[model samples]
Target: MKDRHWRTRYRVGAYEVWGTSLDSEERRRNAPHAEPADFGLYLDERWHGEEDARTSHFVYWPTLEAPVERALLIARIKEAAAALRDGATVEVACFGGHGRTGTVLCCLDVILRGTTAREALERIRREYCRYAVGSAGLENFLLNDTGDLVTPEPLRAGEGR
Candidate 1:
């Protein structure tokens, strides 16, 4: 929204993820041109919840170059994927709106649509952000750790923590 300067929107399976930058957050708070988020998955090394919106369920994920905590990553991905499937407008943002944001969105593609890690990653680069999944380590984690199909069915109510 606004000037399309900081955010790039994508549709993966049943969910819509807005890959955005911190700059968008600043612009949005000062004068919002788009609707507020129902959920936000923030993947960044430094930035936390500075623009906390009352309407959003924001999760801070400090990632990139960190060890692949598969359990935690899977949990967060599931939550964001579930929110997207439920038709809630969600935002996935990081420092540049390129790598980290792209990585998570690709993971959501795998969880929600049962896509392969390679397919998911390429999908993000082709459709969402061309230079996404920024870190080679991050990419390898998705390729190796994330099972081909982690969830066969939609998670039951209250399944995510």
Candidate 2:
């Protein structure tokens, strides 16, 4: 069997999700016979690569910030869900494989398992990464049913986005 760069793998109901950093895709692409994810969901505003459109998607999301596009986010989440329903292994990734990555994973739980926002957060934290959903704003967004896309107010000044 080939090695997988997945930092975390967990099942939400019948859906199998693999979580990793952007570097994982690069490594997998370079390695001989490394098993690639059937569908890749890349969440980072930094670098966008030319991954196959049929199998990969790149969403522009900043680090430590809640997604500002509600429709887009939900659409991507639905795409992941659909791919999983088709028996495809979906890999969600960000830069560090924690905050944004975790947030999306939790959202998937909400969609796939019908879990509440809190429930999704807890489950992802326990099963995927303890550091998942690293911001209260992101949590609030999810708890609020992932509504409008407004930038959350920073707790203090000089906080980087």
Candidate 3:
């Protein structure tokens, strides 16, 4: 948005996820290029009003239980990946656009870039913003690598398959 270089455009399955810290309505309106379609993923609990529903935007009520439910997280990643592959822009956001947002951004990176969650986390910090501090638990979950399908068991050694 505003011709600023994005942090990363990652593909998860068939979608793409673009990470950013802009949460203003004006910023959202002007963030993406005209040719590229855009969607918003708001990771805040306060925006969960039922009347605020939209086709292109999702509002998740994050908590300590988990920033996102596992199923929802998987679905969001898949959807974002599809949007990216289709040349659409999907923006993921959090309150300060750092911790929760950064966690999701790292998840997309791991899924699309084939980088370990740790590596992705490092990359985000180095390239995206120095303040990007994703949740350590979420980082571990992304790195678990229990294959494309999430399972109850922890990913065994070398068991990304």
Candidate 4:
């Protein structure tokens, strides 16, 4: 909490994904004439802040809980991934940046890397923060609910099912 606003949580493709907490973002916003922080596109997963202009999309996700609307969350994560692929710096965060923030970051990883939810969770924990996906239930939800987020591998020439 010591004036640190953002941290590079992990990478998706060639983009460096950043993470922050609502408190930190508020700090950045309230400071007078602070250079606009390069939080290019925000995938806000906090329970509040629906009116935040910087938020590309807001999901009312509670701390240490699984996303209530899995489909919508996946779609938003896809949008964020698309923005990242197009050279935008994407930031994902919730109230604390460890629970819900980490959950969404895992989903983004699933979509971008075609990895299973469990695999994405492992990578996020290893690369971002060890305490990420902060609870057992959240971990289970990430493992089970994100089955739809995995991108299937494309068949190459002469390959048949």
The best candidate by TM-score is 2
- Model 2 scores worst on lDDT over the 10 consecutive residues at 45-54
User: What are the runs in model 4 whose C-alpha is more than 4 Å off?
Assistant: 1-9, 25-55, 153-160
Q: Rank the candidate models, highest lDDT first.
A: 2, 1, 4, 3
Instruction: Please write out the lDDT profile of model 2 over residues 59-113, one tens digit for every residue.
Output: 8777576676667877888888889989888888777677777888888887777
lDDT of each: 0.68, 0.71, 0.57, 0.67
User: CA shift at 113, candidate 4, in angstroms?
Assistant: 2.1
C-alpha RMSD (angstroms) for model 3: 6.9
Q: TM-scores of the models, in the given order?
A: 0.75, 0.76, 0.62, 0.74
Model 3, 69-108: lDDT tens per residue?
6767667766765566667667776555666667667767
| Candidate 4 residue-wise lDDT, 1-161, digit = tens | 33233544578656777776666665456534433323433434443433233445676554466766677777777778887777666777666667777887888877777777877888888888877888987898888777776566799999987
Task: Itemize residue pairs with steric clashes in candidate 3.
Answer: 1-31, 14-81, 14-82, 15-80, 15-81, 15-82, 16-80, 16-81, 16-84
Off by over 4 Å in 1: 1-5, 24-33, 52-63, 66-69, 153-161
